[model samples]
Target chain A: MSAAVPSMPGTRRFALLRHGRLLTGAILTGALVAVALLSLLWTPEVPTRLRILAKLKPPLSEGLLGTDQLGRDILSLLMVGTANSLSIAVAAVVLGAATGTLIGIVAAMRRGALDALLMRMMDAVFAFPPILSAMMLSALLGSGRLNATVAIGLFTVPVFARLARADTKRILRRDYILAARGAGKNAARIAVDHVLPNIAGAILVQVTIQLGLAILTESGLGFLGLSISPPAPSLGRMLADAQTYLTLAPWMALAPGITIALIVAGFNLLGDGLRDRLDVRRDVSA
Target chain B: MSPLLDIRGLSKRHPPRGFGRGAGVLALDDISLTVEAGSIHGLVGESGSGKSTLARIVMGFDRPDSGTVLLGGVDVQSASGEALTKVRRQMQMVFQDPGGSLDPRQRIWKTVAEPMGLLEPRLARLQRREKVDALLASVGLQPADGDRFPHEFSGGQRQRIAIARALSTNASLIIADEPTSALDLIVQAQVLNLLMDLQETRGLAILFISHDLAVVAALADTVSILHRGRIVETGRTGEVFARPQSAVTAALLEQDAVSLASTDQLKEKIHYPR
Candidate 1:
């Protein structure tokens, strides 16, 4: 797979430029982030300002992407929605990856009883349907952005924990770990110093993949009216708003629907690209 | 004075394959050996002869069923906490594959300085860097080489880094488990020379384990021939190779000769030694 990556730094750069998935993904993701940032400062109209007369206006009739059922600018709502989605996804992923990776490594290092206990608990959580857990969390936390975040974040923990554990165990079997012990460094020190750095590639890839999933899961919750309570715009909320007027004003669904698709697709491609670039080099420990 | 490394009656048995302690393979059987303060000792065996098991036990990573491994006169098995940590500093190990032993993600200097950071906690960062540079120099690597990762270096260079790491704690003994078997003969010769150099300059003792009898014959001062978990023969390196007493010894020497004769045949086919 290193064949996909050139040996020379100069050639690597040239090859990276030619990587279509990475390039397109970067552009799409970059535009989404940029629009999210811009939404903080300005948009054509206040996303939540109601103007019932303009409701269900077709694209470019009143505002750039026209108005939704609530008569808020579709473009503005979608922009703010992008920002909200990104923040929620970021918070959830960080929470999940940190807690999960810690537990995973601890389980990996301890093994036997502790490993079984931690992993079985994680398995119980992991086996539960993610959407159900989100709904349950929304119920418990009382339906807001933090509730959505907590639900998505808690759901990601088992995913990251399982990845970190499996990868840590694999790395523990490596000769460098044995050499680390021979260096008079104990297991804890080796786990931090040696195992962490080696598993970084896998973690990074997992982080990117989870990020995309977080956005989707967050949007899904929003779609179910379990996220960021209405009047606060979201892509899923916008979709939900577009539902009643679908036949008469199909354009209402198109803008937020397309934007969400592009963002998710961009993140998936970026994750794939990173995996290709950061491929493990075939573990030359032969 | 006690030998730098003295292992006595070391035996290890692996638990049986299936459930129930049916029976275990005798991985090591009453193995005993010693290396003087400034000498090289070789442990030679075929793959399943428990060479690695002995190395593992000697390094205190694994327990022997019943034995004592004394490094710098402290019994490793009995040593605890500070004592065990201190004794660990006195002996270091080099594994068979340089690629496998060196952390690919770690810079070479950090790899070399690892033992020192653990054993010498008070060492200042600046002092550590200087000492690491000197260690790299001693191993015939450029000081700048420490900035690079292990994957950037060739196999020979990685072994040198491993040796430098072994030397970092000012270790009296290094248990090298096939340290050069992964390298080509030319690079192997260079690495062997480096080991010999360390032994002479620092009075470092090495417990060099390898299946290459020729390498042992060249490097070891005292040699032990391990066969099926037992040390079948022991003597001065020259005397052992010159006059083999045990059947295993004779057979090994014969095997060595056959390998050499095959090399000659290879050369003849090539038309020139070069």
Candidate 2:
């Protein structure tokens, strides 16, 4: 039987690439990832520099996007700051997905005491809102970017663990899984060979969605004065700093606020696109 | 002649505790059957008839509540890890729904070569590919088909690929669970014919499970009818078709007999048939 894939005005590739939301989101996310990776190598100015001379100079000759309240060029500060925020978000997502995927697999494979323990632990972790937990953690450890990153990363562990466990539970029940077990494969091999491959698409979709959520959460922490100390030029911190000079130059608060909104919206779009692409339900119509 | 596979009093019962609690459902009752070497025996039953359960028990995939499955007269129920592995090598299965049976991400070559990996270690990678190609060709599939993923092929082609995968292991017996049910009628006939041809050429004992009586009639030498977890009747394919004793068997033989609203006529036919 032939499938019925809906045809649009333009080709599928053209529609996907030319779409402003998808393209812009992809480009922005790609740029952010690249900048984050490259930050290990170089920065235009020492990120810690605090000079009053260059402070608050509007976007002009030497200072692109103007200097922040702390005299660092807003553009350079943003580049490194974007990298730092993204680094934490990416790490948290990866760590959370990996750990959660493992726990989910283990729970699915051996569903008795271990399953109960892991599930209860996940439930307990899920009991608290991630932001609240992060706030509590930052308050205890004092504020720092690393603390926020680690807190956000830790908070995400249960989210993934729950998704992975739920997805894996359903996947393990499929006929092919039964077929693999029939072939005399042990639990470990079946998990690795059969369960993991099938669940990967679902895992990928979840990771993308979680990536967006992670970014939003990290920015939220920075906005709450619980992350990146002071003068780090974080998007949230920049917005906080711009509040004092809101009437003088509304661009200060608006720029960083809009940047955060755009980045978050981009990640959200990318996640949605990925979900549509990776989902098995889409192929049923195809 | 001694039977190649003998199952005695195989009974599997679902515990009456879940959603359908308090209503005891017998998935498989005291059912027994013998499959001769180099023969194609078909087990026919409707949905929820426990034919699949029987296949699973035979293949060591499920543990029966009470029964003994003897493969080549060796008890498979008590078979340990390595013993189960050995049993698996002796008999492989080609599952229903070929698309679901094969891993979507794995290429056909790797899928075919996998069964051989655990059994035949000395078979080099290239040799395995060559053998896989030959196996595919035997099942009316092209060697190039092995490079593509499962989703790349049609339902019929995917079943042929699955048959090729089963053949790669060189097992003595094949438990084909509704191997052709998912295909179109024309494709189903082709796959059935292929199984018959393979059975004749290789002397492989096949335990074919299907819901279609007509399909079983075409290929199975012996036929067993299972109803609600019990083997109601079994005989030579022609004999069972000619003179089915049990009401379940008669309902199976006469088309539309099952869908008849009244059980009175069915009971009469079983108790006293013309």
Q: Against the true structure, what is every candidate's RMSD?
A: 4.6, 5.9
Q: Model 1, which residues run further than 4 Å from truth?
A: A1-18, A280-283, B18-21, B260-274
lDDT, candidate 2, equals 0.77
State the lDDT of candidate 2 residue by residue for A1-286, as single tens digits. Answer: 2235455535766666646555676777786677656766777767667777777777664455766666766666666667767777888888888988898889878999999999899888878877888888877888887788777777778877777788778777666676666556678988888778878888887787788888788878888887777766577777777888777656667666766676677787777666666674411100
State the lDDT at B115 in candidate 2. 79
lDDT of 2 at A52: 77
Candidate 1 chain A has its poorest 10 consecutive residues by lDDT at A277-286
| TM-score per candidate | 0.93, 0.88
Candidate 2 Cα errors over 4 Å, as ranges: A1-21, A34-47, A280-286, B17-20, B121-123, B256-274
Model 1 clash tally? 0
Error (Å) of candidate 1 at residue A64 is 0.7
Deviation in Å, model 2, residue B207 alpha carbon: 1.1
Can you write out model 2's per-residue Cα lDDT over B170-263, one digit (the tens) per residue?
A: 7889999999888876677677778878887888989999887766766789999988888888889879877888988887667634433333
Candidate No. with top lDDT: 1
